[model samples]
Target chain A: MNSSSSGNVGIVIVSHSPKIAEGAADMVRQMVGNAVPLAWTGGDIDGGLGTNVAGILEAIETAWSPAGVAVLVDLGGAETNSEMAVEMLPEDRRARVVVCNAPVVEGAVIAATESSGGSPLAAVKRSAEEFYA
Target chain B: MHDAHASRPGETPVPLTASAVLVNKVGLHARPSIKLTQCAKGFTAKIELALAADGPWTDAKSPVKVMRVKAPQGATLHFRVAGPDGKAALAAVLALVHDGFGEV
Candidate 1:
């Protein structure tokens, strides 16, 4: 994982199950040393689309202390819900939001571990920069 | 450009690289792990995983690989792509991971 470390970067990871989110977070702490802010979401098995856009916005807003925040998600309903939450963010904060393309477990761990010294956004960017041409 | 609605034809894969960051407080578990594995299927790329030295890393596209790799909050993962649409595959994976899956 590689990218430019720019500003404060918080992170939100969504999944269809709460266990997945927790598991990813556990991995992240192992990697980056756990100085950054992180969150998680999981849909109910009943297909409740358990993602709370408003809650996410609130968490991002609160987490947006020094810099901004980035979001990562697994496939299925989580993707749709994540995209919707992005729209919910304020126009200005939108630029701060970054949606990565890595898997939930892998992405969370990388972002969490990489976000040190630099801004969370910067760390996240670094964690995500390798795919660019 | 390939049809957005139509699935792209399968072909030999190439290699690309992308990064994934964890944003959830709880971290990666069963539900998210499976979904991530499913997302990898969208691409024809061969995905491999590497953790941030202290964390777990495995095959990005395989559920079994994912299960083998175990990580918690604040971790980061490296995904190397090898397939037909390595670039696109890498991009998509990065986006999904960066977005935090819209979780709390």
Candidate 2:
């Protein structure tokens, strides 16, 4: 749902269920428009109901931005796997990426909204985390 | 002492206020909430939204907080803004709500 929008902070959504990931991405696209780079991933190699580190890494790659990338996960496993994916990033790229402690659906919307507004990675992460505040 | 989080400063001007009915079919749902936050963030004023006039205000620039209000249709939304751009900020948000977020 995003295209031709670069330089803005990117957002990657991770969930155990593929549908949840896609649905959240859809919501983000609808609310934030196509101004922010975005991607979603879930399930394992066989596309079952579980988090996949490789898929998450691919999603991060797809959503990567010079501005930065914020990763939102649905569950503990998703977050853990996303952390592994971030760790897999090149040393220089790792600093530009972060895994947020926020609700997946709501955080994706808030983060994408913040990113669409050209907010930096920290602000977008803070905006998403505010859901818990 | 200067406090950045203070609701009102010692020499602050009185806040501008406005109210609008949530006429959209689904009230302030995700799309509308995001739009409201975007509109509010365009200004430098301190904007807050509440169901009643007295308290329980939430930052209008936060989509999550705005959506959390879950204001169903027909709910009256009260707004308070304080800053040099308070008047324009209040007017913009009120207009967005008055238009029902472009939803008929």
Candidate 3:
């Protein structure tokens, strides 16, 4: 993980399938390069299809930045697990992270793009959420 | 070049237009579309893109919208840019496409 005090917001991608999470992260890396911090998690602890709360927590830490971290989840389980992961954090750290209601892949890519351009956490979340709006 | 003269009050700004081919091997797929959107957002211009010279333009600054264009290799991309920085925006976008999105 880079410095959490960095100016750029970080991103976390969660999905039921590891491939989906990895592919989305790949697209983000390709477009944004190393401009923003990014991490992703998917599949259950046993390597089957599912979302793992512990893994989600680890990913959030891996991508942490004081600017903020936007978590994009693919399915309901992923979202719920991401929320649980957030709840597991300390009070102040919890506020810096948000689980975005968005289409996971697109949202992550857009969130990362905005973050790469040095947009704040709120702006990054807004741009990614605009897809639903 | 475009007519960049200031418009009279209540007059609509003259939009600058240009065309470029999608010369990259994959055209405007996910990666290219993301690059295009990121590039478009860097400017203050309101930019839109269409498959032809007229009609059905999509916001170029939206990655999803641009990806939906699903343009293939050899496809021509038409652009309409309107703003104080429209000319520069159009130039940058055109240059990106002309360079095959740095993939050619």
Candidate 4:
């Protein structure tokens, strides 16, 4: 886990399928290189098709950026789990985290690129949300 | 010639515009869109990308808007840039497009 530098927002991808999350993160990495901090968690502790709150929490912690962190989930359940993971963080840390309402692959790519450019948390979240617009 | 003489200091720099075809196999999909958006952000100029040469431009700085063009292979992408660095921006973007985004 690389430490996130100041002014760089991080990205976390959550998905029911480990392949989906990992693949999306890989695509983002290829596009933005190491300019942004990124982490991801998918599947359950048993390696089944489900979201794991603990895994999500660890991903967020590993990719924690002082600028902020954006989480992109694949489905509603994953979104809920991601939200719960955020809630488990210290109050101050939780405030800087956002569970974005956007598609996993597209949102991760856009958010990662936006973060690489040193945009604020709000702008990064906006970039992901723009996928829906 | 006449336009150059008519322009005065403090006035806005003339916009640099160009059009190029999407030669990459995938067109402006995720990879290229991400690259294009990141490149656009590198410059301070205002950049717009449109599917047609005439109008209806979208901010090139936005990945979603760039992808919204939904341009397939062989489609033309028009770029309009304005600001002090518009020429550089236009040239860089055109070079990237002509390079087939490193595709082939």
| Highest-scoring model, DockQ | 4
For each candidate, give its TM-score against the true structure.
0.47, 0.87, 0.81, 0.88
Expressed as tens digits, the lDDT of each residue in B32-96 for candidate 4 is 88788888888888999988888799999998888888889998999999876778888989888
**Docking level for model 4:** medium
Report the C-alpha lDDT of model 2 over A32-96, residue by residue, as the tens digit.
78989999998878878999989998888889899989999988899899999999999999999
Number of backbone clashes in candidate 4: 0
- lDDT preference between candidates 2 and 4, better one: 2
Candidate 2, lDDT over the whole model: 0.89
Candidate 4 residue pairs in backbone clash: none
User: lDDT tens string, model 2, B1-104?
Assistant: 34553545542377788899999999999899999998888888899999999869999988888988999999999999988788888999999999999886
In the range A1-133, model 1's lDDT, one tens digit per residue, is: 1222344367677777667766776665554444567666665545465665665565466446346666677775666767777788779877777777767776666555445444347546555433231
User: Which has the better DockQ: candidate 2, or candidate 3?
Assistant: 2
Cα lDDT for residue B95, candidate 2: 94
lDDT of 3 by residue, B14-46 (tens): 788889989999989978887888888888889
Q: Comparing candidate 1 with candidate 4, which one achieves the higher lDDT? A: 4
The structural similarity of chain B in model 3 to the true chain B, as TM-score, is 0.88
Winner on TM-score (1 vs 4): 4
Q: Candidate 1 at residue B29, lDDT?
A: 59
- Cα RMSDs, all models: 15.1, 3.4, 4.2, 3.5
